[model samples]
Target: MNHELSLDLVQSSVLAGVLLILGEFARRRVGFLQRFSIPGPVIGGFLFALLLLVLRQADVATVEFDTTLQEPAMIAFFTTVGLTGSLSLVRKGGRLLIVYLLACWTLAVVQNLVGIGLAEVLGVNPLLGIMAGAVSLEGGHGAAAAFGPTAEAMGAEGATAVAVASATFGLVAGSVLGGPLAGWLMKRGKVRVPTLVTASTGSTTTVVDQGSDTGSDSGSDTGRGPETENAEESGSAGYRKLLSTGVLVGVIMVLGTLLGTWFSDTTGFVLPGYVGAMVVAVVFRNLNDRFGWVRLDSGTVDLISGLTLGFFLTMAMMSLKIWELYALALPLVVILAVQVLVLVVFVAFVVFRLLGGNYDAATMAAGMMGHGLGGTPNAMANMDAFNSRFGVRSERAFLVVPLAGAVLIDLVGLPWIVWCMNWVG
Candidate 1:
């Protein structure tokens, strides 16, 4: 009458790969999904989850997976993120960049506060609120996958499910919010696009290039453009770089996991293994930047990140227990609703004004809604839509938003979330 199927680590990993490919295939075929920038893994994995739900309701069978590799995959991805934190590049972004970075940091804090406050009012674990907050909103699926287990380890049931669900909501909400907001601002005829004027040597004036998305030196930093590619044979060179980057990530992950374990054991802290790996990566990146100690290529690192993140997210999504979210459904909806409302208001009033209230500011506001609720890719999509309609580009927005959203914002945001998780637990 009842049956169960359990998979070993290798089998589970192989299944995850299949699901990831399935998702990608679906995304390529589905027009609506492509429009909203919904991730492929979510589509494929969620469909599987739905099938399992139906099977369980029919009393058919249950399936289980061994996810021993999930944590390492997560750690490797975060380590790639760590490698991207270049303070020298931050300085190159100048004052406006600093302001945008600060705004991102503030948004992360506020997201957590709003989530925690709402959760307490609704009578759920505040840790779940943290998951719905920065863990998913700004951190995206990767963070949800990384921290969900930690929240569960601290006794918050269904935290991962809540986080993943919240992130899915955000991805859609962000995609929709950005275009309308920017369109309204543009139609109002109040904000005007202006050229940037830079003065060097107190006499020489240079006009910043308003064409390229990544700007000059930033191409390498954000892993954009072929210029960042290492010199070697075209096809084989890429494979070599990817392999080298994987090796580097592995070394850092091992060191970070050991460090996290030691720190947790010695000090009774709740430091996650990925956090340790990220920290080591940040240090190594900064030192390498100053000393040129290693042959680090951002393009290769980005590739590694993409591969690991896809696999981790697919694994996380497939493992989700939809039934666990049943009791928390109403509270989850309320929290997400408030989050969307707060984000729109904050971008309209605070972020727009703080960014100087020009056409560039409006474009940046769209990006804020994108990554503020979703991830950097969502932000880029929002900006792309806005630019395509307006017939202009906000090079400053493109430069600052992605640079900060993708890498620098996490420098402060991750530590803050870690602290909040500990305090609440």
Candidate 2:
């Protein structure tokens, strides 16, 4: 079984390249994925997983599950997440953003509780279930990778295997839950799609005109309607000032990590380098917003996110052992089933009411369902599905959901999990 090439590295690199090419191709040529309820990443990942299995069975390719690649990708993804963590977005979203973030945080907590309970009942280590269901499933691959090492340190066997299994199941469940929940909410509320019209005059009108057909209308007649857009534009500026700000923040984070490492060495207190990076980013974003020094570019944030996530998914998929998952099949199925039920009921009743029982509510719920179960892509897919049938309010969903999935909730989830671990421990 010895091979010259590093099997995991080679396989993941190859898979990422293939996914990028196929993703672009499918996005351009086969619009069915965009038209239909399926998510592009989900489709890509599923096809890749199936292909890997087929190749393995045929003895055409061999893959060794390498856990090492997971950390760098995870750190890169989280750093991207942090770079977008401007308080401006939160301020712009206002009460609605707060509600959504709180809802997601609550869901993460509930997910962990459900996992722990299930594991205790099934006589497996509760930490294993917690890692699989909450950390991996709700938090996606980044959290899975972050927690995998922690799980091992805490005495959970096959922590990486559990993380992989949970991430796979999360992808499937997240994609499935979002569209149906949004559809159901729309049906229950009798929400009607608004007539979209664009004025041909004025800069504001021109911007509106361009985005109107795509249903990105936000009711504000301003050139830039929301905080997210502003932050994105601010962040995207490639000027010396913006680049300097980003670099300064990056340096601060690096310095913080070094300080933490030294402190840990001296006082037996451990700090993750990514955590230091995130803290620095958060602080800088807040300071920038307060002082009007520089803005965060949405395009840059999105670009970093896409590249980091692509690499992260590649690492995750290449490290999967299909055979190992077979052993945990029964519990995995049960956990997924419970998660699906929980999401459906939560979105239908609780989330809708909190969101004011409107079309936007339905769309937002769909996005949350996608994120809570899968990740940001799934959330976007759900919104896309809702938009295709009944014109989407793109700004509302796009601004809110991405902020929730990409930054706020992700940062918040880590500390909450640590708190839970302490309480349980």
Candidate 3:
């Protein structure tokens, strides 16, 4: 009854790939999964975790995985995120981008404070509260996996599992509530979606003329900034492009690991390796943008990001020891529930008004709920669903939400959360 099965690094990595494929397959087949934007990896990985939980409870063999590649994959994905954060894009977003970014940063701080405060009241580790807070909610599964080990090292038991679970809750909660919140705001304000006109040239062209007070067309330029130039560089064959990107990412990861190790040793402070990699990547990205030193392609970077994030997330989810969270379960539920309530209130009252309180603001509010409680993808899904229903796309919402949620928000949120962790530890 004590049998154990251990998988080596290669086997574990392959299994993670299979799980990713399985998740994608299920998503393709399941309509609700697509509607909710539930990630394939999460679907597959969580199912596996559930199976493991049942097997363990039934006294069946327990399996162990070697997640040696998980860290590297995580760092690579963050590095790609760093590469996307161009100063020019931020500038293009103008005043509204600054406001939205500030809102997201504020949310991270609020989430942590509320989480830690409720944790003390609930008689649970404050660090576990942090795990359930921004680390899981705003940070999503990626941040949960990255910071789980840090929390565990700082004496929080089952931090990874708890954070992962909290993130999953946020993903679903954000998806379910975002559109409704936006819809309610729009209905109350009598915000009307701008008419979308279709012009038929040689090819059919659709134009969005958003001249209504429902949204501000301040920074409505839909160009992707540096990505537009980079897309041309991606004209090479797919395999060659991927290989080149891999090499560049590998080199950056190495440098980042070294830089993080050095910083930690010198300052006696813990700096996650991904942080260093992201910093280096940001520098490289900006420098490349200004000088065009390397032919960096955005498409390839996105590809790498998708692949690494999928594999890393699957590995992290499948390895979760859910049984360890039983003692902290009640506190975790309370903290997550409160976090959801706070995000809803904040988006409805603060984020909507600040973003201009138009139809555009309503769409962006839906996006804020998406990324505020979940991740950027969830935010996009929320906005997309809202926009599709109204038959209008808020260019401003698409630009600001994805840019801030995915890149700029992390710039402020990460350091603040890290400081809180160090202080609590």
On the 0 to 100 scale, the lDDT of residue 224 in model 2 is 68
Once all C-alphas are superposed, what RMSD does model 2 give against the true structure? 9.1
Q: How does candidate 2 score on lDDT?
A: 0.68
- The candidate that achieves the highest lDDT relative to the unseen native structure: 1
Tens digits of per-residue lDDT for model 2, 131-209: 7666886688667766766666767766666776677677767777777777877777887766778778655433335
> Which is the better candidate, 2 or 3, if ranked by lDDT?
3
Write candidate 1's Cα lDDT for 273-368 as tens digits: 899999999999999888987899878998888889899989999988888999999999999999999999888888888888888888988999
- The pairs that clash in candidate 3 are 214-358, 214-359
Which ranges in model 1 have alpha carbons more than 4 Å from their true place?
187-189, 193-239
Each model's lDDT: 0.89, 0.68, 0.88
Clashing residue pairs, candidate 2?
Answer: 232-297, 232-298, 234-295, 234-296, 235-295, 235-296, 235-297, 236-297
Clashes of each: 0, 8, 2
